[model samples]
Target: MPIELPFDDEEASTDVDLKTQIIRFILTGAGSAVLDFGLTMLLQYGVGVSGGIAKACGFVLGTTVAYLINRRWTFRAEPSTARFIAVVALYAVTFGVNVGLYSWLSHLWSETVIYSALAFVVAQGVATVINFVVQRAVIFKIR
Candidate 1:
């Protein structure tokens, strides 16, 4: 009693392992987060940038590494410019959440960079959920 769609045959042919995908995603994401956090600290404290600016810049830098590796290596999708564009659009949407939450939380906590980073973590957590779903379905068309 299952509905057969246009992609049922295609989906059946692939037979991808969902658990492997999840594990790869987590491992790759951990590497990307280290890049983000390390860069954020360097930009903010080492270079005198503001908390919001540092996190924003880090988000861009980190996501660049993420998209390239995730698309090419992790998911092993056929590269598409349209999918890259979708990623940038999603990043733009998440950018607001990242900066806004970081600034708001930092203000409440006496402007600690640690607080800002924690806030960025929360914001990126939200973005991560959206990114994984979209990447698997729309970007990679993975089953």
Candidate 2:
């Protein structure tokens, strides 16, 4: 049975078509990834921060952006404290997976910005898949 929310009766809080949701998720992810990549590059190259540190900061920023958009636009759900905290916990897990993959894969590539971007992309892809599935089925499911 679907869980009920206080605002469930509102049409705005209901799920859209599955394909539409996937498209929105991808679009939202692309925007978030741009922010993440831009911030990481700026901090790593311009500010002299370590790659791992820069990536971590970028991940946090990206995740925050993703959550806000996914909550309102992608998932079309009313905000709940428990759900928000659940997203934080989910991202915390993915952060380790994303950063670890990025860091480990860095050694396999040449020392260039393109190579770094490639590594980040690979890690981000993995995290993205995991995130979408879990968020859609679990965290942000229509109740």
Candidate 3:
């Protein structure tokens, strides 16, 4: 028997098709990542904030932007208190993963912009995959 993938299903639960949704999600993620990374660098290097705290601050702001755009555009979802709660819960999980990974990975190398950026990218990449999967299959799935 062949294993089925969510994106392969023709009867999608979202307003947008899975392929289109993935594309939009990637685009949205790119923009969000820029905001997240830039803010993290500024706070950590420019303003002398601690690494984990800076990462947490950036993740919050970036993910907020992502949720707003994704609801209106990517998933075509309307605002709902239940959905909002779900998203916040989901973000909270990813927040720990993203920030924790960044903190751990950054310590693996000497403090420098290049090393920090690589660490950020690694952590962000892991969190991004988790975000897309959960948002598509659970939170934003049309009921």
Candidate 4:
């Protein structure tokens, strides 16, 4: 017996398969993470900014990058005000989740780079799941 995929030939040809979208999303996420982490570290260590503020700044910049790449490359969606609004709403929710979780977790651990990075990872992981699910199922769902 052979395993069957959800999409058929025509759909696979015309639409991006789930696997491809996921791969692209991961790649996009990696790039975004680099920017986010870099900025956070730079602000917190280099500029002497507070952890919470640095995290917020990093998250905003990274999220903006992720949204742009995910919209055009990952999901292959056209630009729309409605989609933009939906994304903004989604980001707002994730922003709180990501930053709040990081702040809380960072406080728990010693004020070291390793500990801070760990907190950031935990928060980013949670937010990434929420973002992928909502974006794939709702914001960029295929008609």
User: How high is each candidate's TM-score?
Assistant: 0.80, 0.88, 0.88, 0.88
Report the Cα lDDT for residue 39, model 2: 94
Residue-wise C-alpha lDDT for candidate 2, range 16-101, written one tens digit per residue: 87898899899999999999999989998889888888889999999988888777777887777778788988999999999888
Question: Which whole-number lDDT from 0 to 100 does residue 121 have in model 3?
Answer: 94
**lDDT of the candidates, in the order given:** 0.71, 0.85, 0.86, 0.86
Q: What's model 1's lDDT at 68?
A: 70
- lDDT computed for candidate 1: 0.71
Candidate 1 lDDT, 1-143, residue by residue in tens: 32222322232322346776677677777788888888888988889899888888888887887877666556655556676678788778767876677767777786666766677688678777777887777767632
**lDDT score, candidate 4, position 124:** 93
- Is 1 or 4 the stronger prediction by TM-score? 4
Candidate 2 segments whose C-alpha is farther than 4 A from its true place: 1-11
Which 10-residue window of candidate 1 scores lowest in summed lDDT?
2-11
Comparing candidate 1 with candidate 4, which one achieves the higher lDDT? 4
Write candidate 3's Cα lDDT for 78-120 as tens digits.
Answer: 5667888899899999999999999998898887889999999
Give the clashing pairs for model 3.
none
User: Given candidate 1, what's the lDDT at residue 133?
Assistant: 81
Looking at model 4, residue 64 earns an lDDT score of: 93
